[model samples]
Target chain A: GENVGLHLPTLSVQEGDNSIINCAYSNSASDYFIWYKQESGKGPQFIIDIRSNMDKRQGQRVTVLLNKTVKHLSLQIAATQPGDSAVYFCAEISDSSYKLIFGSGTRLLVRP
Target chain B: GAGVSQSPSNKVTEKGKDVELRCDPISGHTALYWYRQRLGQGLEFLIYFQGNSAPDKSGLPSDRFSAERTGESVSTLTIQRTQQEDSAVYLCASSRRPSGNSPLHFGNGTRLTVT
Candidate 1:
């Protein structure tokens, strides 16, 4: 089973603080990774992405870090805002496949 | 008009019935995908189409589930003899290509509730 999963089901953070979400994947052949944000009733929105060749990639207020050796992935959000409260998922794409394998997801709760 | 569009924002059907979900992808996009999301769950890959050619239907759950695309314009996912477990949101996404570099553009999705 090449499953991609997250370490925690939920995370709580204070406003203006940093939030880190962790994920682990079992497929070693995966070469591409992405982070998606999903609100209460909306589809997943692409946040950031990283390739196997690169260890890290940054977007507006988000960063995605990948460690191929440990099959680990993380999404870091800086200065968390109330609007950032949502479910975050890490999806990976195998070198041989076109479909993405998504993690269960981590629900982020921001407290003011 | 710029984003992917899915029809029947909400569907409520009885068990053993058949249902068809439609997806209208962004114009000129060659790649389209269908995914399922259960209540508070992760997205599950259903199927994907690269073009007018054959699609990758490996992610489909059972023999009762099938999908088809018409010349890269629209796609329909058909579920026969649907069960309660089939209740979920069916999402449609499209990308410029099937490559890794192209990010998927997702639609609002069709919420199907099988009672």
Candidate 2:
């Protein structure tokens, strides 16, 4: 069975600092990867995504780096703010399927 | 212009009862998905519907879970004889297409608590 999972369950960071969340996936055929931010009592929101062809993709204040060779993915947030506190998940899409396999998720806690 | 919407934002039911969760995806979207998230956990892929073709229900935890979609529009997920472990947030999402390039638009989700 294919699975996408994270390295950590929780990450605590100070405001204005940088935050990095790591994820590892088991499926080598996965071609698309996405990072989502889920706030308490809300749905998962798309943050950024990277394709297997590309190693990196950047958004406003977020960056997603994919290492297909290692089957690893990471999300980096710059100048973390209190509002950035939420659970972050990494999802992978297989080349043959439309389903997105989500990681266990890492909770980001920003302290002011 | 609206995003994905789910009905019965919160549901509470006794054990052995059946529950239906509805999802209304954004107009014109061709792909819909259903996921479950238990407390302090990640999104569990339950089912996916792409266009009018047969759906991929591989992620469904058990036979108690089933879903249906009318054309490429609204979808309903039904849980029969729900158990306490069935308590979780049921999320629905829709994408412009079934391709990897398109990101999914999600609804707030339906919280189901089985007591």
Q: Candidate 1 docking category?
A: acceptable
Instruction: Name the runs in model 2 displaced over 4 angstroms.
Output: A1-8
User: What does candidate 2's lDDT look like per residue over A1-112, in tens digits?
Assistant: 1111233478999999999999999799998888999887889899998889999888999999988888999999999999998889889887687888888888898999
**How displaced is residue A61 in candidate 1, in Å?**
1.1
Q: lDDT per prediction?
A: 0.88, 0.88
The pairs that clash in candidate 1 are none
User: Candidate 1 — what's its lDDT?
Assistant: 0.88
Best candidate per DockQ, number?
A: 2
lDDT of 1 by residue, A1-112 (tens): 1112233388999999999999998789998888988877677888998999999888898988899999999999999999998889888887677888888999899999
Fnat (0 to 1) per candidate: 0.46, 0.53
TM-score, each model? 0.93, 0.93
